[model samples]
Target chain A: MAYSEKVIDHYEHPRNVGALDKNDPGVGTGLVGAPACGDVMKLQIRVSPEGIIEDAKFKTFGCGSAIASSSLITEWVKGKSLDEAETIKNTQIAQHLALPPVKIHCSVLAEDAIKAAILDYRSKRSPAKAAE
Target chain B: MTTATATILKSLAEDRRNAPARPVYLDYQATTPLDPRVLNAMMPYFTEKFGNPHSRNHTHGWEAEQGVEQARQQIAELIGADEREIIFTSGATESNNLAVAGVARFYKDKKNHIITLVTEHKCVLDTCRHLEQEGFEVTYLPVEKNGLVDLDLLKRTITDKTVLVSIMGVNNEVGVIQPIKAIGEICRSRHVFFHTDCAQAAGKIPLDVEDMKIDLMSISGHKMYGPKGIGVLYVRRRPRVRLVALIHGGGQERGMRSGTLPAPLCVGLGEAAAICKREMATEAEQLTMLRDRFYASVTRRLPEVFLNGDEKQRIPGNLNISFAYVEGEGLMMGIKDLSVSSGSACTSASLEPSYVLRALGVGEDLAHTSLRIGFGRFTTEAEVDYAADRIVEAVQKLRDLSPLWEMAQEGVDIKSIKWAAH
Candidate 1:
């Protein structure tokens, strides 16, 4: 199947394709998807004290759709507050990429990665509250 | 940089942009382009000499019948069999179905067991599945890591109740040539019928029905650069291999396959077989060199690449390889200009790795990352070089964006880390 132009764009020139310092307090890493399923995405977000996402990066081992999904999400999540990033649905990403039904799961993975990364960031900032 | 160098780079970019957008053809295992000579031979049959071979009263019918008989002779000569043994069908899939299911059903009372490899083509396996439902038992034997059948295992599997043993001459995905001679001898000694699916092997390899002790064999036309929708099944005449008719009608093809024969397709397959018979030796040598060149060039520049199947025992035109830490679909996308199929192409819609690789004990991760690049008689050295460079470039780009690759580069055992239990 031919990939969409937007998918090709993201795959060819993926934005923020690298890892953040996972050990840093400000960096929250979310690794989702499974290798056996033929996709594994690692998305990371760096949050500022003002609860806004300062930077986002991703590394993905998958089809073009999955890489594009993660790359597109990294671009979308940056500069948005963690709460605002949480509002981004997988459907939006799927529509923006013009992904086929078979590849919709990639967009879902990206959305799950966003939520997981936000939770990791919140827990790091408030460990006692997270424990409760 | 000098202005001359900058200008050269700009022109190169422009040339690349203006280049033809078609991907270079490399998936020969799937199908091959029809040979021009074969087409030329079939053209007359399609136009002026159009007639049903089954019609006996007309001149048109007589001419068409002669064409089909000549075709039958050509195909039989290539395989060293009598012309009377050749039965034409739609293609190898139908040929296999007829050989497996037809033979099993005809001999169902005397023998109720059929044996075949797990890696046989889908048609053969599915035919066995259908037979199983009809109360016949089947044994699906596994291959070794090199994708070769074990002779000792075959000897142990056959029983007095086993009527037929069907194995393929060459694997479609991996291209490993099975030990056909050994299997044939065992089957002959045990008084069992031996059939081989030679769709990928007929024109590419040397085959003799008598020497191999093969009772029935399947041959595909398109695979050998002939027209599609035509194939041959070689059923031994001396010992008279019996098969229940799959399609019963006008009693064409000695009553095994009953249908009106397309004279043009029959002529095309004949010409193709003749060409293969004459040119196979030199063509095989050229293909082997080109395939190895492609393999060597890619493996030299890329690290952590593994060739799947037994290299030495495989056919000349096939190379199945796995690029570490890269998904097969992603790699194909990265090298968009090269037409290659993933090992998973057989079950691509299901997102599963190839059963052939799985039978060989290949890990799911590597199997998912595997690509099958097939060389053909038409492949050139220049195209191979271009494909190698593009593949290497794509793998590097994807690896740069792969977290697993990064971890491995840093001496981290990726398998040691617990993955999400999705």
Candidate 2:
């Protein structure tokens, strides 16, 4: 199938692709899934005390669509509160990127990866609350 | 390169100019056009002398039997094997299965171990995999970057119980020629039976069974421009290597493969072998030139392009190239004018990258980016030049739309650019 113009747009000029430091207290590092394909995508976010995502970065090894989706997600997640970022759906990412169904999984994986990262950061920040 | 392709280029130029411009077949490796002479010779068997070769009944059977035997002689002659040693089967897949699993079953009690490579054709690898289910131990040898198996590692992999060693004569993907001669010698010294899936190598390259010391060789009729359902399993008759039958009915094909013989296919295969014997050297030389021209044009135009496998050691008809950050399938999609491949046609339908590439240590990204371009007897200089230039153009167009390219331009090594972990 031909790639959508938007997918091509995002693929050709991906907004965010490099990494962020997980060591920064404000930075929440989310390293997640797919050891089989060896595609390890890290979505790191620097969260404010008020729970606002200050910055975001990601690294993904996958197809053009996967890279674009991860790159696009990091760009979307930045500056939003953790709750706001949590609402970002794979469908939304797919629609924005015009990702086809087969490739939508890459976006969903990225979206799930986003939530996973936020959970990781929150778990690091408030251990009691994370456990609760 | 005249020393390289003089005769081939001269003939190819004439063939392309004279050939018809219809039915644009890109799947040359699948099968080839039947030579008219081969067809004419086999016509009398169908109409005037139709009979079952196995039938000891009458003159009809006698005539048909004679034709079958003659075709058998032609096939045997093509590969330099004795007529009795060559047993015709459906195709190489069956031929490979028979050789691999046949050996497995024969040595099951005496020798439980078998050695093969992961990059083998599905027929061989899957047959070995099936043998594993049946309680036979199989060792999978890995290939180097160029797809060559290390003879030393092969030696180490062999054991007291090792009964068979199956490596393809030439790799279907990347067209890397393996160290079959050395591997054959090693197996000979070890007293292990050596088998080669020469499906790709049989008609393309010069394969001498006696010189190569290949005991049981697998060859496909279609790959050599013969009928698809016919193949030759060259089992050494002098020593008479033992193999258990995979089938159990009618005791046809020496009880190794039991089924009604396909006279038409056998005749077609015989004709193909005849043509191959006459034209293989000249065809290979021409294909080699086309392949080189294809590579040179693409490399000259495209930067950051990589060719997979060893260049010098590769077969003359194959070119496996990777366009970094661009998906091979996507590039193929954009290339409507050209009919080609993303490697062996077997894994073409699967979205998963080629296992051959994975075994060669190529990353999924690169594997997905790879394209396997094959030049056959029919491929021309114009087509090669067009394909090469178009490939560069296609990759550039795709990359220009890739967000990955911007990061690349910004000096962010995609490899070093770590993703923020979730």
lDDT tens digits, residues B1-422, model 1? 34444565578669969987768889999999888678777877876789998889999999999999999999999999999999999999999999999999999999999999999999999999999999999999999999999999999999999999999999999999998888899999999999999999999999999899999999999999999999999999878899999999989998999989989999999999999999999999999989888988988899999988897998998898999899999899888888889974312456678888888898877888899999998899989999999999999999999988988898988777777744
Q: How many residue pairs clash in each candidate?
A: 0, 20
lDDT score for residue B331 of model 1 = 90
For candidate 1, list the clashing residue pairs, or say none.
Answer: none
Off by over 4 Å in 1: B1-21, B345-349
User: A12-97 in candidate 2: lDDT tens per residue?
Assistant: 56676556666677778776543234234567788999999988877654455666778789888888999999999999988988
DockQ of each: 0.55, 0.09
lDDT of each: 0.91, 0.76
Per-candidate TM-score against the hidden true structure: 0.95, 0.77
Show model 2 residue runs off by greater than 4 Å: A1-103, A106-132, B1-49, B343-351, B419-422
